[model samples]
Target: MKKQPIHKIHIFGSVGSGKTTMAKNLSKVTGIPCYEIDNAVWIRNPSVDIRRTDQEIERNLQSIVQTNSWIIEGVHTKDWVNQSWQHADIIVFLNTSYFTRTLRIIKRFIKQKLGFEKANYQPTFRLFLNMFKWNKQFEKVDKVRFLQMTEMYEEKLIIINNRQDLNNWINNL
Candidate 1:
């Protein structure tokens, strides 16, 4: 079968669910620019992270979606981000395992602390702990909420739980 042309992809998941990785890889292969929703939410500075106004975020996202093709990924699922989903040709929800996300969280923290990984913000212990909290909240609350929100887009939504399945789906794409 001929592959469908994907103009826009929205990928959302918990902190360590590989959303960024998937977006980057997809962008590389498809020649689409990958965007981080976090960048839309915050103006990153070495000393401080400033939050963007809701209007600013909306305008930023509007510009991206107006482009021909893009791959936007992040954990944001609020109303402000609903426009991205509305414009997406595909929506990927990574329902990664709790145990796996936990492992990735620890590994990411260590790598950031060791300067092996580049982080958008200072990787402090508080933020490291928050990753765990966010992950749990995502599993307990956001996961269900996301499912409910995306039900209207069922035909375009894809839920991935493991690396193998993700790889297969990517290969097929």
Candidate 2:
């Protein structure tokens, strides 16, 4: 059966590719519960670098699967995430340019500095450096790996390459 992903949507992309924003808007549009995977995986400083225990992560993900509807967004593409690809009805890959991602990261930093967004409690300089590292590594590895890994998978895999006419862009999919 050709399934429609009105329920489980897994959105992945390079940093600052607007996965969170897409999830938020899609959730509003579809009325499906959206879980920011980062929120589940991270607990912030003084708590633990990776928040969930193996069991905890499994349980959390299991609950989402059991619900039969979810939208997970983040950069962590573990083996388990590949398994997530199997069940996902829609897999959205935001293949944005490095320059765009870089600009978005800086803008987000400005938002944090201006008290518009909560500083996820990560140090500014280290986070900035980490983003640079990710930006470089992402362009070189992630997309190629994603294409290879998902070559045979059956899902509505979308590549949002450009930001122009987003609605038209998405509608084409």
Best TM-score goes to which candidate? 1
- Residues 61-101 of candidate 2: C-alpha lDDT, one tens digit per residue: 66676677888887766655665677777788888788999
Q: Estimate each model's TM-score.
A: 0.96, 0.85
lDDT of 1: 0.91
lDDT per residue for candidate 1 within 89-170, as digits (tens), equals: 9999988899999999999999999999999899999999999999999999998888888888899999898878898888
- For candidate 2, what is the total of clashing residue pairs? 0
lDDT of 1 at 86: 90
Cα error, residue 74 of model 2, in Å, equals 1.2
Model 2 steric clash pairs: none
Off by over 4 Å in 2: 1-5, 45-48, 51-55, 119-123
